[model samples]
Target chain A: MAKTPDSPLRVIGTSVTLSSEVQSRIRADLGFAIEFDVLDGSACLRRGVTRPDSFDIYDQWFHSVDVLHTAGSIMPIEVDRIDRWHQMAPMYRGAGLASGAPGRRQCVGRDPADVLFVQADNGLGREPTHQVSMLPTVCNADGFAYRRELAANRSGPESWGWLLEQNWGARCMLSQDPASSVTEVAMAARSAGLVEIADCTNLTIEEIDALFVLLNRRRKAGHFTRTWPTHEESVRLMAQPSTGLGSLWSPAYFELCASGVDLVYATPIEGYRGWHSGLCLSAALESAMCDRAYAYLNWWLSGAPGAILARQGYYMSVTEPLRDVLTPAEWAYWYEGKPATTPLPGPDGRISVNIGDRRAGGSYQDRMSAISFWSTIMEESNYLQRKWLEFVG
Target chain B: MVPSSERRSSSSRKTSDPIAERGGGYLYAMIHDLLQDKIASGALPVGATLKEGTIAAHVGTSRAPVRRALRNLAKSGLIRAADGQGYIVGKGAAVPLSSRQLYDTLNGGIGAVDRTVSAERIVQIVHGAIVAVMPFGHYRILESELGEHFGVSRTVAREVLWRLMEQSYIHKDRKSHWIVPQLSARDIRETLQMRRALEPQALRLVAHGLPSAFLTDLASRIDAVLADFQAVTAPRIDAIEHDICHNLFEDLQNKRMLASIRRNQIPLVVPRIFRRNFPLRDDLAALRLYDRILSALVSGDVDAAARLLEIHLDRAEALMLARLRVLSVLPPPRTDTWLSAIH
Candidate 1:
């Protein structure tokens, strides 16, 4: 499967190496024979991380694409390939584009249109998996988990409010990821008249001080145990018989349940917190490898063995059938309704616990947003996380 | 948003270490690797206690070298802090060597169910988990780790961290990376001033928009207080006062207004305030003022409600300041060394 001796395909990825999950998927499924080098983190930061005119593909996240694209680090996918490419959902098609940059477009609704002009003068095929500054990837969403026994222990919205009203204080295990999930939880709690967020933006010194006073009161009364916990502790306590509820991302929640806990994920009455990201080819690569990169992408999304392997690496895939892949227990607990807790809320504001999207009776855009939001969240989560640490640590 | 370049002085200068000079780029990898090891091997242990001095000593390095390491640890879910204590190893410390697919499987499963765990219970669980991990007589774990062990969500976590900071339980750099905060009378005084500003304001609002249901609830609560005062076998007078005051003021219905007031006042005062012996004098005055306010509200005298509100707030401020004055005289750590960036 090596490239013809006369022509070679080269790829330079930021943060991903030849040994990475995505690369292995490409190697295994697409069977592309090419030289792939992963630029170190510092290399990307130092600028000109790759040799000029050395490679054909430059893979990066959608959020980070701005600088690279502007610097002509990579070229867009060829135009002819866009129509032939697998279609993406419409929800995340144009997310995180620096508010108003021209040339960014949506293709197949699932992927962000990678602006060809950002890096090179070539049109590029857009994969709808996620909006990429460089390459394609799935997204993530924030979800809730609850103790079966606790929900059974109480009933109705009043009890639900009472549950959060319990004395543990900020000891609740929620991610500081800063995606909508955190705000959703706080907002929902506030809406239910249970908890309060000091201020969303521009919290003054006085507000911060007031939070401290309330925190001290709660601390003295043991309202919040300690503000923050490690993701691991958050996971463990969620599974254990400790607290009654937790808030986290779908992937993280999945990890906990796979560890053999009886916990279940719940969608609050509120909407899921969301974000998206993507993959792109580098401009510095040799011009000859563009087609092969497309072929590799197609093969990866075709649900072939390599793609399956890559999906297993924790990154969501656009290839596989989500329903068939999930176990019956998993399906019922996650996608289907888990009988033990609040049923997953439908995209409709109704209280249906059914996991599939009930929005106008289709699930495509919902699924795309689910993936795009995940990636965007992770990339943007750093600041929210820091802020959260400052708020409660 | 201060320009990133402009924001890079003073705190950034003094707070940054040689390791940080390597930048968030280099540090992330090293920290990630270190955390990967800690989470994988359970060397960090779920719910185990953490200490700056101990971590510094065990790693054979100074506090600066270990600061980035601890921040990285905290980021990865390997560690947290106990309130007024130190960091504790978190359950996430034991990250499994699963493929991302396995993680997906697990994460999907965890995400699917409706587990209703509260923040307090989560904290207790982590605290208990650490306690379980500790051997007999390791009080240092409780003292060192409780304040640092908070969940990862930025908003809520920041709240807890700020509290730890206000109480001199934890500290952070300009980028807001965290460390266990040291406590002193000075810190306590500043915290009191913060309490003075916010607490009374919260009380005032709770008075203004005194919901009908909350008022009924307060009536019963006051009756309970009167009952407690009358009961010959009453356990603690302060308990009744605490309950009456807490239930009357902590109503969720009034949270927005109260939170609004408190949010504006706490940070401005907390860094300068210090904690002292529970100020019985202030507490008594607060109790009497609350009683009068409750009476006025129950009597439907909006004017009395307004008057008592001002009195309550004024007394709280005066009492808190009196305490702060005494603490200011203590031979505390260099007060200027503690920046307002504790949040």
Candidate 2:
């Protein structure tokens, strides 16, 4: 598409994070024209890196900071321009890990903070700086979800091992994203004693080879129903009565719940997979449109957007604004580990939670503290991609 | 130095230069020297037939030069035209040499370890061919086919393999076959890191000795690419990288360090591989970095030039690694005649 000097700030991101409702609100409140292009995961990353001139602001997971920053596709976001800059210091440094987690200050691979801060030398680093790679937005702990009625055993502590069992047969589903799917598969395989993996976040060549070799055998035996890339596809595939379990994100899980599907989010004792999404300023953005971009970045930390994300089970960076927009019942049920006082709405404004029901993982802090690994690109990510594609083939 | 007929001897006396004596070019002189040595040594026996193509293939040249050499030999009474399309080694009328005799003459007792098929030229060509398709997958270099393709002995092909191995471009498998290893992200990262650390050190070493005229020429190349980004070609980008990453260090004096720097220039090859299927975009960002480094070098700011080279290497490693991951889905190109996919 041709863009002019006075064109609206063009934002590109996955449907997982970007929404039409946010576009409408940003257009009305920011007093500027806006356009959003929602693509699947791979297409969004490809477009963002290969053609930075195509968009103004990019919204996606922070794992892409290394890719986007290295390509010079994104510009630095000045922390000073953020309204609650000092107030959000704890979260900026936290990188979605709660202070009480098992390894309180240790992160094995990448997190939002690992590549978030901009150094004096104009490079990305972990230490806090006046500039950052992205403005941290919606983050949450994700886990596998399965049909409660279809599962063989329902009365015990759930294990990640169940997804790989032969009983699930062809009813099992998984994501096509290698970063998340590889880690999730390794966790399941290790839990089942099928293979031993030293670390899930960063995989070695031998471990990846071994995992895929075994996965190929399992896959050939009809262990997987299918693989999906977008949340919408996940919802459509998992809605089938015959589908047993699948790797799922919050949005799809909540959508299925609202549409009245019987499924359970298994917060395995092993832990939850943590992910953080954020907003970025494009390197090609015209200087005149920068102030409006800052307003939009600060707007994410304000009240309304965080509440909308909360309906999809995501927590914002600063919790104060979210408290104002959500009901006391919604807040307690979603953040305080309490039973729902009444039915809660999904992002689509449908009643997704019933009265007297409790979330599988408890409050926001409880889920955040249980994150086993953040979805990240490994040092051998390219090799892993090659092997993963061969396995899929 | 073998004695020819009096006519040949007189011709040699008339001119000290061998090419002038032969009335042909350098290739003709080379072919002449080779055939005369083989014929005088009785390697090509009295009845052996020497075809133009046979002499050409033996010395790794074209028929034109070999024809000149053979014709000159015939005029000197060394070999004469036979009834067939070849020449007879003996001057007098005689039966043409058997094909078996010619084969034996040309074979020249070549052993299993033949080592010199224009080693310098072959290594350069093979290295480039390997790098172009390396990102795809592991490839087995066929020694026999390599020899046949170059019209050299297997020993010469093996020598090329050894040279490639010394440069870390290929490896010997358990079967002792020469194989080019698959290119991986880690390979790209390590190469980039090595270049980042070494190139700046190299620039500092050779900076003072670099010629202003040479540096000016390189700057012009960068400006040419910048002048029209859309019109840039792969070979042009390659020449620019070669001038900076490679040719600039000819006077560095540190052999091991220079070799290491050359090894790390594989990032320059990644774009060439991709350019085969996609057009290269030499946009302002990369070219400006090149311009800045050259400007520093031209101004005698060695420290500034070195610093800029390090930054360039860092950015290069990241970009190359990403391109490699994108190409991971496609297997290595299967088009090379002498390369077979190991998988």
Candidate 3:
């Protein structure tokens, strides 16, 4: 039996799930059309768990692995089926076992059972379980961004505290996502000397109170210009003449640069907030659809998507395959964080990085290693969401 | 806060079990030691008031231990009664003492010795032990074993048993043995049902009375937690829950409602026990939902907060029940020597 256009494999994720370049490459390289359904984070999770029939594959972050698995909404993929399984970075393979730092653990890699291949009878063990919850894909570290023009006159080093400075009053913006925003704010609060938090990742009620008091006072004083709910809004906010500094995702930063905005994504002295995005199979997929999904997953790992994502400022799980797809200049500029030898195109094929342009943080390894924390669903996330809503209001 | 070195020393000397160290007897000693150290070091100014309720909330414990700690502080001459209010930091003895002398006195003097366990302390100790073991199954508690374990008289042990009976944690059998009730699916469902009915109403009643500054601060704290939800621990979740569901509602001053809410917290014992024995399980969805409810409350949308609270409770109920089922299948936890389950 042959698959037809009427029965395209359904894939659900956020708008930026697959860039146009990657999607086109999938069609050209894998010879299959994917029906993409882009939904917001909450909506995506709801649809993925409640109506598994609605999508065959999910492209999202690893933080939701536990929630999805617990809901019985996703099936484990056999590691043997993922042709590039052994090629994954050791940092991801060993997960958090390699990193012993207090707050630098990537959520996905921190728990082997959550992401690694597990056997049907055996749980999420360290050794190969022959099955995995999700196939690792593109990942990147996130940091704040600022208009170079606004920060040109600042005296001190680039710090997260700059977001809370009185000078940037009504000029700074924060993401509206509770997990990301709260973590950013905490980093800012700690850097600014407004509060002393034991663990910026897991703030206590008292520490939270101290941080928010400053935030509320600043908010009432018109310190914040906007709270963006989406990455597009974040880019828009950063582009606004009045907005000087704000939280930014890597893709957005690339988009802004491509649009000729003179902004510098700050590799703050504090550290970057890292995150990893991956692919998950829906449990409801039929045997035929499952094969197509595996093919799609394999195609992503075949180097084209990784190379495309690298152009947009993301590092793929397996860098070996990506090396073949990218030129030496591209690799040096993106991964090494060195000055670009030649102008590089953004994912949209627009000139984003001019020759001699350098990444703020030196090297992907340096930035990833310096991660003070990762975007996570904290234990107190319910309270966090409520607080975030209040902060937004 | 007590210095980590002193806390370690005192904790090691007191009990090996972490749960016991968190309970009333150890809490009282820890608070007393910490306050004495603060007073001796002059970190607590000469006139600073030490209110039991404030101290209890700060240390994440009940007023029982704080009250006892305060009494001990007063007895040691580190603090004196401040009119009709509460204990105030002071040099109560006729002899003028230097900071070093006071420090020496606190470290090696009258308050350093082990005090006889009172009936109240016995009650707290037994309650903590019961909660630590309740998930395993029904256990018969012998008055003689309880007395011998705590080095208390049988009369004192009987008082503790009576207190447990009053709290509905244990009941006397026909043979006069106190039996802890086996936790059932129905009990969990009922407890959650009570929580659903009462907690939302409590949030609604207290939402208006809460200070905007405090609520804003609370919202910010919640935001911080949500920002890194994956790294969150069970204790952190317990603290946040205390702030939203217990601490905020306690301000309503509804004695009966507050008491009923406290009593219905029976299901919390399961999670507390399970977490002590197992690695922290991910509860991100509940935390995310809680974040939304806090957002509503902070925005002054009392109705929305109440509605969200209901949904949050429902989700929590389901998650907790599921966890309870998992816990039930695991082997019975190792019993601490201090916690004797007589046949």
- Please list the Cα RMSD from the true structure of every candidate, rounded to 1 decimal place: 27.8, 11.1, 24.5
Provide per-model DockQ scores: 0.02, 0.17, 0.01
How does model 2 score on DockQ?
Answer: 0.17
Residues B230-268, model 2: lDDT tens digits: 888765675666667767787779999988987777556
lDDT per residue for candidate 1 within B270-328, as digits (tens), equals 11222122212224345456667767787777667666766655555434433333332
Q: State the weakest 10-residue window (summed lDDT) of model 3 chain A.
A: A105-114
Q: Which candidate has the highest lDDT of all?
A: 2
Model 1 regions more than 4 Å off: A1-26, A32-86, A92-136, A157-171, A180-189, A192-237, A282-296, A304-386, A389-393, B1-343
Find the candidate with the highest DockQ and give its number: 2
The interface root-mean-square deviations, each candidate in sequence, come to 23.1, 4.5, 13.4
**Distance from true position, residue B310, model 3, in Å?**
30
lDDT of 2 by residue, A66-177 (tens): 6777556788888778997766747576443544345443444466777888887556777777788988888888899998776665566787877788875337888887
> Which ranking of candidates, highest TM-score first?
2, 3, 1
Of the two candidates 1 and 2, the one with more favorable TM-score, higher being better, is: 2
Candidate 3, A17-110: lDDT as tens digits? 5656667788788676678887766567657655676788998876666556555568888878989888876655544522634445343223
- Residue pairs with backbone overlap in model 2: B113-B155, B114-B155, B114-B156, B115-B155, B115-B156, B116-B156, B136-B332
Docking class of 1: incorrect
In model 2 chain A, the worst 10-residue window by lDDT is A98-107
